[model samples]
Target: MEALKDYLPHSVEGKNILITGGTTGIGRATALLLARLGANVMITGLDEQHLKDALKDLYKEAKGEVYDVIADLSTEEGVNATFRTADSHFDKLDILINNAALPAGKVENGSYSEWQRVINTNLLAYTACTAQALERMKGDGHIVNIGSMSADVREETGSIYVATKSGIQGFSEALRKEVNKSGIKVTLIEPGAVDTDMQDQPTQEKKEKVENLEMLTADDIAISVLYCLSQPKRCDVVELKVRPHLQII
Candidate 1:
């Protein structure tokens, strides 16, 4: 007569969590939900105004502490600054959600600087953040990486983006194995066609697509992230691929 709840061993309450690109989209939704669940949430963003705006909303429902840092994750100095700020506020780390990213064009369409920006922001930042988090996470922390379906689909005219996503997919797999023995769990949550700022569509158009089940909301992916985090230590929800029911690709 063992209930399903008996197997759910993890609880986010009081855990210190760090989320990047949390000013909007999936990262914002995840931060808000976790804050309401009584977790100490720290969010980062590139824009100071955006960081302030997100913190304003997070504190509205937050039961535990909530903090924000404004940093450009594409650079090494920025990554170091993010962790330094986190250390000042939180004594230790419990969860790291690598959700920061950007949209990109084809390799030939953009300049070398643009390509570097995309790669640094979308791919290298995840690895850099994980390294910093691993130092703070003694043995039993969770690292949730927000990859994309682009890794699998590899759509045309999106070679630059595909490259970064593909890198993340491989990075997450290797990271999981490397951290497995340390009791650290790594979960890769890949979402498809989410109606976020990254989407090149009007808000109403995006809503219509969502209503038609052709696209998903940020909250949809947030719930998936929460599910992966709430699993028992013995049960790792390794890779979760979330797509809208009617999304063609």
Candidate 2:
């Protein structure tokens, strides 16, 4: 097991970071890791109670400023509110982790409204947030998009989810080419199934399969984020894919 201290470093010290959906899963794990490493981090989530609880955990090890805002990233107002709140906390943004996403089970099984919600949350919000971050980042910044292997290894009943992940893969690539000249680095992290609350709603049999498969933990993805941030400004990790050794496709 890799300890949190092992991931800490002076490279990210005093850097201002903003992570969406930071109350849980990869976002929360990354927030905690960066906070421990001496970066001033502001995280946004939709749940107030979750935000409070995540803050409690963050305060325990955060060496730099830790702030959070409760805001939905699906709506324009929510997106604006998040950046407004972040701006008040930090003068300049060094990193933007677009980790907020909604998983959709099936295309045919869901209604149009449900489809819209999933697309807005998973795809549109990421681009909108990136645009906002680019404005605030000036000429130098790092944008890490948390994508999924589902984009490539598609499965039946996962059409909607796969569509969004696929969009992220393409978006990250095009955006990277557009921004790299400005000294901004863009990274896309595609990971196989991870053990998180996101998996709690699956069927018992499905959950059993995941448990047996030895899924990647939230910290595993966080370490990937840290690795991207730790690189020197002259170097950029364009895309990183991770999967549990036992995970098939």
What is candidate 1's CA lDDT for residue 120?
A: 100
What is candidate 1's lDDT per residue for 1-249, written digit by digit as tens? 456664322378889999999999999999999988889999999988878888989989899999888999999999999999999999889999999999997877989998998899999999999999999999889999999999999998799999999999999999999999999999999999999999989999999999999999999998898899988788899999999999766
Candidate 1 positional error at 121, Å: 0.7
TM-scores, one per candidate: 0.97, 0.92
lDDT of each: 0.93, 0.90
Q: List the residue pairs that clash in candidate 2.
A: none
Q: Which candidate is the best by lDDT?
A: 1
Model 1, position 76: C-alpha lDDT score: 98
Residue 98 displacement in candidate 1 (angstroms):
0.2
* Model 2: per-residue Cα lDDT over 1-249, one tens digit each: 545544447768999999999999999999999999899999999888889999999999999999988888889999999999988998889999999988788777989988898899999999999999999897889999999998899888789999999999999999999999998899999998787777655656545655676577799899999998887777789999999878866
**Model 2 clashing-pair count:** 0
Off by over 4 Å in 1: 1-10
